[model samples]
Target: MTDQPTTESKGQDGPAVVADGLTKVYDGFVAVDHLDLTIERGEVFGIVGPNGAGKTTTILMLLGLTEPTDGSARVLGMDPARDSLRIKSRVGYLPDEVGFYDDLSARANLRYAAELNRVPKAEIDSRMDQLLESVGLSGTADKRVSEFSRGMRQRLGVAEALIKNPEVLILDEPTVNIDPEGVRELLDLVQRLRSESGITVVLASHLLHQVEQVCDRLGIFVSGRMAAVGTVAELAAGIEKGHTFEVEVAARAIDAVTLMELVPGVRSATLDGERIVVTADRDVRPEIVELLADNGLGLLGLSTSTVDLDSIYHTYFTGAVNHDNVNA
Candidate 1:
């Protein structure tokens, strides 16, 4: 901790991050290829791919932990190659496996991190307290890290990352082995960070459903290349009849199949069980509701139904790894 490097950086803004034609190679093996990405300030961006898809390599290149074989990136308008320290000062990273001193208490571990980051002496204790409470770990403040649960350690890892108040947070598989409740708590904390502090977050994970839960936009990676990038609906729109919606009525509206087809963007409509599923080019819930009402059909329910993410992944996750192009 005593030999830790200190960094001071001035604030600058454009996008929180931007990468153009970024590439990485190792021992003649291509780990990442021609990557182009832009993450706006205060946006939650998810980089989604399976293991061996080069998501971690891409993240490392962006963070300057690994050098790119070609192209470049700007994090907070600073080149990671030349200004990594400055960028690091303004960014926080939480890897899938977080390590802490087993013999130390939770508070002690965080204090060490605060010192390593050169947090102001006067502000360190207060910040640590606030963070512990926010992460739901106040009760475990004095508990030895060795005694903590995996979820507890993850919560503390988040607090440790934020001790310096970084503008950008990069989380690599933030939720992995935790329980369902722990996963929910962590995801909710991410939401609160965006809504309350307007922090920019970059989440890299293979969990499709979790990524869909919180990201504003997604980058689909496959075989060391980005196959596509956009919102769930936008990505879905690129597929034939990818976007869909569901509607239910008080009675059997036999005309629903006919009415939905008349709506713009609708490719096909069919009745399935108690619901009418409408496959469309975009969200047509408003038009669908109006259409139902016009035909004297009482609207019992209406919702934008997302395509199964596994199917979406199978469709886009290809060896060719080419995508010109989701509502989740």
Candidate 2:
């Protein structure tokens, strides 16, 4: 790790990625509008939204693949535009579509990547061995990439990104078009990488479940702008006035719904047959339970629900947004 940009020598002291008022415009349309973001070291940060929500454009700016029309971004404490070469050495990137030589065996392709990243000759073999098993590809290492499934290829792409032993990793739409099991495997691998290596990761995707499954924090993008950024609970707290809970009573508590509305923290309550849906600024389950017990009603069940990622997206983009207007 000496003089190399491995996770060890990088010195995790400050934010790994930062963007201040970062804006990108394609002709007359805006792709990213004054975006401000901060990703801490050793955290898996997910950027999520629907397609054409400016996620790719933001990633391009951060990678220095495309210039931002306004503002600036920094990766690993260096300006991406001017220090792109140095930053690229420290940051591993995986695009939505990973390409590999169909004729090359998985092991052979990894060897090429290791060499390209300038891994020490003595370290390359051991590193490859470790990575293959880590990504669940050791059994198929000698097989040609053409024989690998879509999941296998993505796993290989992850191994390729780690060949450099990068301090930071950025994945764009990593789980798109993959089966459910494949998505789960890929996301699990992401969590393992962070826990084992403490590498800072930036993941860009439109899949809500995938992001929530692994990321420590999430940034919700909407029509070239960020609608919210935080943990799922924090974002949910800020999105609507509060949280929601679904409660069920053994008896039909239709009037209980109206009574629940008067609870200290409850905003409103509605009855769905025997189920009661209560919206509140804070948790009022205790008071509700007390009320039921006082009335000799039995509590059957209780559940908490947050403002889902899809609903959060809709809150910002209520109507049709023509992001195609921006060509970036």
lDDT of 2 by residue, 1-328 (tens): 2133445556756799999999999988898999989999888999988888899999889989899899999898899899987888888888888889889999999999899888899999999998899899999999999999988899999999888888899998889878889898999889888877778888998877778878888887887887777787766556555567999887767867767887898877888777888878777889988988888888889998656767555654553323322212
- Against the true structure, candidate 2 reaches a TM-score of 0.76
- C-alpha TM-score for every candidate: 0.76, 0.76
- Which stretches of candidate 1 lie above 4 Å from their native place? 1-11, 241-306, 319-322, 325-328
lDDT of each: 0.83, 0.83
Given candidate 1, what's the lDDT at residue 328?
Answer: 24
Worst 10 residues of 2 by lDDT: 319-328
lDDT computed for candidate 1:
0.83
Q: How much lDDT does candidate 2 score? A: 0.83
Q: What is the C-alpha RMSD of each candidate to the true structure, in Å?
A: 7.5, 6.6
Cα error, residue 163 of model 1, in Å, equals 0.7
lDDT for 174 in candidate 1 is 86
